[model samples]
Target: MKKLLAAALTGAAMLATPAMAQADEGKIQFKLLGTYVMPDGEITSVNTDIVGLPAGTQTTASDNFVPTLAIEYFVSPEFSIETICCMTQHDVDAVSGLTGAELVSDGKLIPATFTAKYHLNAGDVKPYVGAGATYFWWVDAEPGADTIPLGVTRTTLSDEFGFVVQAGVDIALGDGGMGVALDAKRYFVGTTARWYAGDTLAIETEHDLDPWVLSAGVSYRF
Candidate 1:
């Protein structure tokens, strides 16, 4: 991940020099976007491991395409505050290590975030990096008979804080009235789920909800 960030920064710097025609400062920019969540991350359950449910017991969230809306207020020529608006739904799945059976299927997770960005240069083509916080909520879980050993009846994931790191580039289109934006954000989210068995306290397990989100969109500046 560090290598990827370094490469992106290097590439963005190379592209920054030629597109220095400068965008308007203090303007509001809106983006209509499409996003893809890469399914390369994992969620671990030590409770399942403790119970010795299976050898390869693992949990993962599903990946899909989703729509997103983002608004950015350029505070200065090189700085902006951004908030992405969208309800992202992901299906969580747990697989049994022994029988290779799916234990929990179709559990849902949703996240929202806010970021502050620093544009590398005040140009028509802007490459920037950002840092932010995120809120993750777990909802609607379907745990099957395969998951009984974990004693999880009601699913309650602790709503907690997470950090976000992002990098993006905006390229001017036509005469610079509109543009295209390509962005990537990596979320560092880890939390514990309070599992209940029929109103009785059951288990607490760690879930690593880290995900890399990639987006592309059209941007309009005013």
Candidate 2:
């Protein structure tokens, strides 16, 4: 009777091992992060300069830090799909020619992005790399303080599509579905800025808005 009981206990242990391993791998994860947005807002070219912008007129966009939320779904143990939600604001100012002149103010945007990531699991540390697409949706924008003096009553930015590449790492705290996450993404995007005077378009300029996004925070999986 003791031999039979020992064999039964051994079989149960073998069955529990697989269940414990599966429990450690979660299917969904949520991350709350703080992100630093740094953008290069250099003017690539002037499409239409009705206001007679001075020669050597150059522009730049300001940087911002905001809260971000990321959701990830693991399709397999080594592959996952992820998306993030965040809204960032920026101001465009002249860096040269009319130095210190603000050209655009309070430009709010939402960068909708999706990525497919491959994770390399090395013990408790998992590193991932991904590439995906993004769409820059301009929610609101206004002419700057200086532009209002130039009969610029209204301003608009074109919504555009772009691409992004991502890399990050997740360090597991314990067997419990909690981890610390660090991520970085680089975006290649552009926009056309138009300033209007009543019903007439006054200025149109093309800008390169390549931005580097850095984030760090805690993540939970279930």
Worst 10 residues of 1 by lDDT: 17-26
For every model shown, what is its TM-score relative to the native structure?
0.75, 0.91
What would the per-residue lDDT of candidate 2 be over residues 34-120, giving only the tens digit for each residue? Answer: 999999999998988777989999999999999999999999878999999999999999999999999999999999999999999
lDDT of 1 by residue, 76-136 (tens): 7778999887665554466444344444455566777899999986456789999999987
* Candidate 2 wrongly placed segments (more than 4 Å): 1-23
lDDT (CA) per prediction: 0.73, 0.94
lDDT of 1 at 137: 65
Top-TM-score structure, candidate number? 2
- Report each candidate's C-alpha RMSD, comma-separated, in the order given: 11.1, 3.0
lDDT, model 1, position 62: 68
